[model samples]
Target: MSGKGALSGTEVATHNSRASCWIIVHGKVYDVTDFLDEHPGGSKIILKYAGKDATCEYEPIHPPNAISDNLPPEKCLGPVDMGTVKRVEIKITDQEKARLGRLQLRPPLDEILNLHDFEAIAKLVMPEKAWAYYSSAADDEITHRENHAAYHRIWFRPRILRDMTHVDWSTRILGHRSSMPVYITATALGKLGHPDGELNLTRAAAKHGVIQMIPTLASCSLDDLMDAAQPGQVQFLQLYVNKDRQVTRRIVQHAEKRGIKALFITVDAPQLGRREKDMRMKFDAEDPDEVTKSGGEVDRSQGAAKAITGFIDPGLSWKDIPWFKSITKMPLILKGVQCWEDALEAYDQNLAGVVLSNHGGRQLDFARSGIEVLVEVVEKFKEKRGITFPNPRFQLFVDGGVRRATDVLKAVALGATSVGIGRPFLYAFSAYGTEGVDKALQILHDEFEMNLRLIGAQTIADVVPSMVDATNIHSHVVAVPGDRLYDSNYESMQHARLRETTRAKM
Candidate 1:
């Protein structure tokens, strides 16, 4: 038994039943026979690997320490011979394959075909509190409904009879080209949706050749996210300024070191809006019950709760942009910008781009839809001011309630250089993990192509304001006084100077 030709370990052990197996650890043989009843992942999958070398399969399914801790090591009879174990081949029939495929297919079909399809399903799949936190908006949720309702107001006047056999849906954003006009916006608590969380979303985006913006409150660390991404894949890091500027600086520096293409500073959430659903649920601002209820501890590394707890530094201002610029060469994008004046101010700052968003109607209840503001902002820049950035070019990314490719197409047709999708992909993750996300991307890409063909445009660059007829396009504009713009600029400058003073104090 000591020789190489002989079985020296527990492989030669004898099991009382052929339906079970034995494993060797620390030169001891343990019969997993009666232990099957105590298995957590169902004994059937374990039984399939019985009477054979189950070491490889067992280690991944159940860690050795897990088995050792739960089960007494004395269960091992002795150091049995190793020749008795044989590998087993589990054959899956065509019927079984079809059944599993059907099982996987039913979820996406029943849950993600349309924008509304996933609302109830998401609520069903996720914990009640977590669902409420993501779905609810500020105050009465009128803005939330407005975000969706505004999409209906901009009716598409699709054109026909133009040759569009081969369309180029790809476009450049932040000097990097993406496969689609859309990218995943920053959404937090990915692990709440699935165990893989941001990793799964990153994989899905990589597979489809789209960029995924990692949120400030991502469950996975910034380094872990960078590791999950493929080399040269584009990723944008979203930063939420907190009470501590040092912590925010660390995150921005980490993004720069890890090759994050852009830094998105979400300016909308100076203060957390009043999400009534969480309020009704008695969501503890200190220890949100969703953390424990969702099967884990809350990650406070991003200091989100601190902001929610009224610890935010109210002195944050636009003059801080240079500090951000000095830390990283990557483009800085301002998210939640709604007005044309702010858009102009963003351009004047020499910042990279502006995401015309209202935090998906979660931050402000009365703010206009991101797309609604997009048309006016672009019109102001291109038609009124006649200003444009060169090379990488300035971008107007719009988000909120974008579900279809046609919705994206309409956004681009109106004025959006690119679009950000927030809720739809989250729904996809809930319905199915990475696969569901891939399906959602595929559906959107297909719709984008079809809509492009219908509109008589072959390339994303060809989609411009002229392609869209102004006859049926209903539009609205809310004007802010010249002083408001001047005040915003003055406040931005004042904040920048304050940051300098604070640095001196430190």
Candidate 2:
């Protein structure tokens, strides 16, 4: 299997039908005929690349181990001879060529002053498929926009005449030290943006003393990331529970064994949303007939999320809470708790914490922002628990649209343990690799120093509720000035234009 037993492109191209499908992915030949019927994205898509190198289509959305993990060992048809393998000549359009050109022309890392700058440059430089997948939110994208908009409603009640001396943003997340009051939150399929993917995050987190939440569907395999971690660097695992309990059990136990500091059970996304932009760039559009043939109610239109996340167990409920506890000693934190009732229940359940997030508005459209949810959680805590956060027994955290240090400060003041920023770090590495992340951290450090003094605080602990007035945080109808930076940088919601019908060749 390891030898030069390479098949020529001519020999591979002969088997081009559904009955005997052959394909090459990353220089490896695989006879996916049997696996076709069982493939989650359906057979037609794989069948579309029958007898061809599918590496271009296969790379972005799927994890590196996806083919190996899902395909039977017998189907892996050994190595492909690259010298004889005919290259798939894709005609590059002018727009695409210009987009690719931006990669070489990106501004220097030092010029990128804030998280938004990374987003701006990444949008300009990233390939269309990658940008579409990374930026797409749920239907209408109301909550997606609101995630950042909610921050504008809260006004800072800055105090003057403070000592104005040395400020410290360093704090602990899940009992581990951090350089700032923020964590690099989980985002799937890192290789879509950069070659190294989440390893970029792992390296950046290690360098700066922040926790990186490993996504279940990361392009890099679990061991790939765990192996890359520096000694004693705290990591967290975000679970998208598999329907097969054994698989879920193995994953949870393995993460615990690997010394993951905490287990973040994703309580949202019972179903991945209709990310239309991703759907528009359909990878599996070639085989719509497979849906009828397979006799499954699969939605081929949901794009990358549907294809990759088909394995997540939608049956996850409160009953499964104790089952998660029965599996590992790692502290449990619900990664997507929405409202006060759920947060209260999490407290009663003896869970370590709750992340007030809506899966970064990728799950449900119009879902309230995490910071807004934090308001209700803090209010409930003050009512019942008689504590306004700093509650070691059950910490509460928030994530989503955290572009500025001021947002973290606001959440901390309103009773959050810390905040999580996902997309910015993703954009950072996408634009300039690991150094982009380091620079983003440095910018935050500068902002934390200035913002803390302005708000009359010397440390994270001093960022109290009085420092930020959130009287309008929950007012969903209130009109706030639009975030021009985010709006200008954001690619607006794309409605899929109908594909042009092919004409008969003369």
Candidate 3:
């Protein structure tokens, strides 16, 4: 069992049962009998594929090295002899063929100029399930729409005739160097979009000198993404506190030991939102708490969001701050601080920073966008904390509906140390893989150069509050122009298309 080229597929197949189980993954045989009950998705799926090649099922959900990383030694049977192993032929359904056909027809990278274009193409190219999960927000999606609309309210007051020969948009985020005033933010279940998952972000961020925040639920294991990075490349961890404090402590300490620069504990989403679009696809068979299917009920189709988030603790509170601080020396930041009071509290607690966010409008409906909250937070910081803008002790960050360098500049101009772009990069990689991410970064670079000069700012530091009139920023009642491109990319709800069924008539 320890050596390669020993076991045959026929030999492995004999162990299939509840008592003993063996499966082949990436040519290696694994005895997962002990792991069935331990699996987060539960035991049924593993038992279904017992003594067979589970690579196809496993690859889509777990990281490439997940089995190897999690399984203990001796339970690890060595590689199967391909010569003796019978090939498992998969039956491709007509709908899968059709979806792949659409994937093949996607626009070439050279034709994609903007982030919205990547999203438009991704909607056309990605599987319906992936599109629904990535694009969905909370109920009614008022907050989701508002996130983008909020930026439009803050019109730029660009200066003229300033020397703009060489504009520098590079800046520091959380005291770490960055090529731009934005970082690639965390998003979950990336393999549903592409096989490499968050590895695309890791590689592109390394090449571009941009920081990336790794999601706890990313399809790739944290080690896989971190291992893919070049030395000195900075990466941050976004934590969704585990219900088990011991589990949370271990994860936090492990991240610190792994050289993670910061910890952004997500403060929003104490309870996962009812993203109806995503809920439409949740698998009833695997769900224990699935709502009864009916008009406007929490049905099973919530997909990855519902499946992977069961471990998150709803009891996470400010009291946990000292515990986190005691566990790791890494800079700790509250990732979903909604208002300035919380920002002040974070400052008072001597935490590193706060990210003004609403979980990108996925946690709660009608939540104001981070930029809108940034105004109140900045104003309050000065008034309550006696902390002025750009206070070194308490850095502020913002994310959501930021589609352009100008949106980033607006946040920077107000007081955000930097902004985070999540779905755009997810869209970029979903459509074009690693190269798409590179191109997205390139597009931002080009936009930053042009927008900086146009705004009369030669550097990121020059982007001050006076450069823009935010008089209407917090005025939610004010009308603002719509984002036509983002609106066009959005598809109204429809039932998930079942793969073209082929049935035999009796």
Candidate 4:
């Protein structure tokens, strides 16, 4: 096991105790005994599979490079002789059988008329843990609800069309041509929903001529996704600055070298918000004894979000911006500016642009929606710097609660150069894999064509401020009109269920 040659399963099994544990991952054996306690998910999960193949358990939640990134090179014992290893039997429960049946019953892809349809189907078929992690937002989830509700207040003001027969929704983002004005925004742990994970997105985006923002925490390695890309397929990078400067530098320089079109650095999460649903799911999966293993010193219940994000540098600030600029010549844009003032600062700082976002409402509860922030940014930029919408020099992007093509048009009408859609695509692929995403993009394309004509706009440029009335966009108390599509897709929060009591038997 000392060298890089393949080691037999019997040899690895000899070091199965806590004193010197080794596990097989992707056919490689690693000594994780020293790493068990520091593992963000906790020591017990790893201990259960000590000296065994953990690839099945490890694939869904972690990025591909996680083990190599965290463990020392000396600890990587060698490649395992997988043929000689014992395979763990995975038992399917009754609940999973039921879920599989429901998955088969999903309506034909053609029947999935809108993004909401995909969400409804995914909710019924996705694993409970995946569903919780994908859907859970910050505390109270008020921001999450409001993110969608804000769009309802925006009223379209269509004018008599001069000629509606021809209309196109194609637009450019950060100077790259896109099929539509939407980019597949970054989402982590794609393998949680589908085995292919972000690769499904990469292939689909390439086929549809859509730009994808690759996530720092993607289950597939960055190089894997890049290698998967077709020649001339454009991609962007979304970075969560690492605590180690060298790690961040390597990542940034490598991305630039790999032909990344732009760098979208996430500036919202200093710490991930309290997603209670995700936390509860972690509790359900963990052993009770493991919770007390660290003597309560380390809280292992922060769930999937916190487990993967412990390396993020909380001290990230404006001071680090110059260093990022120095390392790479890629056009930089701040990804989570929530206020018009901050948007103004980004503009003043001469960055490429700023995405008026709240980290898809997963970071700060009650934070304003990207569209809401778009209106303010547009107005403030015009007032303060005398710059207007569609400024080629500095672009403004929006993301969050965007499910419809009409929503994209609205954001574009207000000021956004483009909008980013995250969960809807995640749901699409989760329900039906790559084909689901292809249909999802096609649905949007159709909607854009029809909506553009209906709104009496011929092109993306024709969608201006006068086309929509946002007079009530800021009114929080106004009862939003009942949306049957949204209502059907929305799952309300549930309280804790009472445990069943055992009765005395005769």
Candidate 5:
């Protein structure tokens, strides 16, 4: 059965039981009976589609190469004669019909004037699972709400009468030129929102000359993203270290070999957090007994994040940094540093840089926002290392709660090499696919032109620490002010709904 021409449907159907199961995905056949015990989401899901095509169920959540990468070459049973195979017919539910209606009613792309606009539209149109995974943070979501709110505490101090006829928002990120001070950061499972997935960002970034950090859990294969890039397009890799050292090493070495500019190892999330909204979804439908029979002691209630994250190594530590360095020549950066001490440690360790982020407030609930951490990181760097801001040797990057070019500029003024805009781009592509991302980038470009002139700064260098008052950045208990931008875009967390009962006869 191993690559011996097209297998007939009759032959494939014979191995449907748990004793020996075979499935078709994107035209190829695979014998997954051996893999069932190791499947992260549990074997039940795959068993549901045993002896049939699982392409529809597999496409959104798993990377394109997931099956091929995990299964041995001999397990690949070659392509099947699609004509003889019975395809799975996906029924359109009432909820999907409503979502489609909302999609039809989406605001015109030009009307999406700000980054927040894309988010507002995305909330209306995205699938519940995708929205929950993207928008939900850790328990109570305090840091999630605070990430954007913290930016509001900062007040800009615009200059007067500086020649701002030609403002340049363009800057270099880790030695690569970017058209703006913001780069599209890594967010996983792109296909949940759009079919093109991470490729939407790749194509959009290429057109706008922006940098994109590819997520380790991207639905599209790493090779697919690289193959889609235009000449000289700069992209970075965001890695979640695996339990198997050899697997992690292969990923790192492969990324470097494929011209990945830098390696931004995600230092956060040794284990995926309890994002309650995501937990509420509880994607797995199989019984506990069934799941345990496959993957030992599985907690299927944790939803999509838990389902796909079993491979992450909790044993990863500082000692592993040297091993990473030994495997590749690419510049290495820690992606989830939340405090100055860790940032300084990264510098001392002779690493490239640190991203002052708290995993977009999706990990620890009360963790400080990246922008707030930037101030502390900068202050410590100057005092402890006698280092200046935007040090070429140790670049300080920031991500989380950035919704506007003003937000990007504020981070720049406070001493960030660049800010990573994650959710807005995710929302953009989710709502409008590649075109949505294009409009979002254009909106930022327009905002950069207007706000840079308004702030009286002609270039990224003109954005200085003194240009913004961050006195209240650390004060977490200040009275809330009405922010129209945030109010318009923020989707409030909902309480569980009561079951509908039959109305009494009137």
Candidate 6:
């Protein structure tokens, strides 16, 4: 089994051996055993490259700085043969590593573990315009900053030394179980971050035992996203409401046929918001063709602009929501609802769920942060509207500015049944591609697990409002009265018309 005569036999024998061994690549060694369960691309790829020279192949599969000397030596699992493996590594510089470390890495975690960390890194990794496109709010980005900043405003009363050891982060969303309470939000143009795009993201999400919301404007096709996402892995579709009704119908039908359990129809963007970053960059939202033509060569910074140009479809409305609902029995979740009024409306319309969000502050600049509205929305439904569903009941998911396990716990305590993560996953995608995304998610899961134990909560259900001080949570005042803030524009116009009509009657 040791010589050239037995080379093939030795290789065959090693594959079955229970013994684990280390492999060296680029002057670094990695312990492959522990990573078997954690491989983002799948264990088969890691297994195939086991005990072999995998440097060239693995090198191309990850961002350059992702496997640097600064990373734990244990995380390096040797090199593998490229001929039989799928290699997908986007170019990442050593400088980028230092930058990501300095900007994105929160002490003890070099990768994005939470939402804020991702937002910070995204600003660094992308051009000012692209970053603003993802991170900016409608007018002033007030909600964007507040979404994360508000998390600190809520103080957690942690109870120490309550449990002996056992803890679990696993939970279920819309009948699908996940390893943690958080899931990846559907963000368009993933190819901007890496070539594998949504395909890689869906695969990574499934591998991690969490849910992934596939966006309507995904770089990959719906069929491909569904195929990559394994069965029972909690894959949901995010609809951007394209102008063509037939296109929107096609997307909804595709999700239904593919077993997607939820339809996350984004409701905030009746028209694209005024993003100053994109505005400053002279980004033409109406003409994606011009932007793509102007953006030369897809690099880390400018890729998103080019990618976004391909996916953003402007026309969609509330009418389309019921149309989608009528077509599919799968649960419908309306994303980007920023106020109690819309949440109440969603409940009144009998939708399965509502995601309190500000589009990661990417859509509206001056909108209220999603976390700022979480408690109010939840209270409106649970108490005011008397809205309740069967068994697990109706859920409220929140996103935009969620960056820490505490942030997630805070949102949950405030009435969010679960939370969605956006920019952070994109940063992970940019920084380390799929592996980076997986590492980022794992860190968040770990943080949630540890925090749940520290707080003496055994399960996600145990994370209740009692853990949060409701009085301290931030609140905002809407100028318009009643629970119908969406009609603000219409109300103003109606008032003017009524005054004219009254004068005529007089």
| TM-score against native, each model | 0.67, 0.91, 0.87, 0.96, 0.92, 0.65
* lDDT for each residue of candidate 3 in 172-225, tens digit (9 for 90 to 100): 987899999999999988898998899999999999999999988888888888
TM-score (C-alpha, index-matched) for candidate 5: 0.92
What is the C-alpha RMSD, rounded to one decimal, of candidate 1?
A: 16.3
Give one digit per residue, the lDDT tens place, for model 4 in 1-506.
Answer: 23347899888777877788899998889999888777767777787788788999999989998888789999898798887888878889999999999989999998889999999999999999899999988878889878888999899999784699899889989889999999999999999999999999999999999999999999999999999999999999999999999999999999999999999999999988888788777766766675576443346456778778888999999988889889999999999999999988888788999998888778889998888888888888888879998899999999999999999999999989999999999999999999999999999999999999999999999999999999988788887787788778877766777756799898
Please write out the lDDT profile of model 2 over residues 60-84, one tens digit for every residue. Answer: 7787767876777888888878777
Candidate 2 has an lDDT of 0.86
RMSD of each: 16.3, 3.1, 4.5, 2.0, 3.1, 18.1
lDDT measured at residue 201 in model 1 versus the true structure, 0 to 100: 82
- For residue 72, what is the lDDT in candidate 1? 64
The candidate with the higher lDDT, 2 or 6, is 2
Rank list by TM-score: 4, 5, 2, 3, 1, 6
Candidates ranked, most accurate by lDDT first: 4, 5, 2, 3, 1, 6
Clashes of 3: 4
Per-residue C-alpha lDDT of model 6 across residues 1-506, encoded as one tens digit per residue:
12222223233225421146344344344556554433333344445555554555454333233333224565653343333233334467786577556545433345444544544545555533334444444455566566666665676777666672877767778878878878889876666555676676787787888888887666666777777766566688887665656756776887888788788888877655555544434322223343245332222223223323323346565666677777788888888888888877777778888888888776666677777787677666667857542125567888876667877888776667678987778767665568767777777878887888888888777777777775655544312123121112111101112212345565
Better of 3 and 6 by TM-score: 3
Q: Which clashing pairs does model 3 show?
A: 281-301, 282-300, 282-301, 282-302
Per-model clash counts, in order, read 5, 0, 4, 0, 0, 14
Regions of candidate 4 where Cα sits further than 4 Å from its true position: 1-4, 293-298, 502-506
Highest lDDT scorer = 4
Q: What is the C-alpha lDDT of each candidate?
A: 0.67, 0.86, 0.85, 0.89, 0.87, 0.62
Error of 1 at 285 (Å): 12
Output the lDDT of residue 63, model 5: 68
TM-score of decoy 2: 0.91
Give the CA lDDT, 0 to 100, for residue 143 in model 1: 66
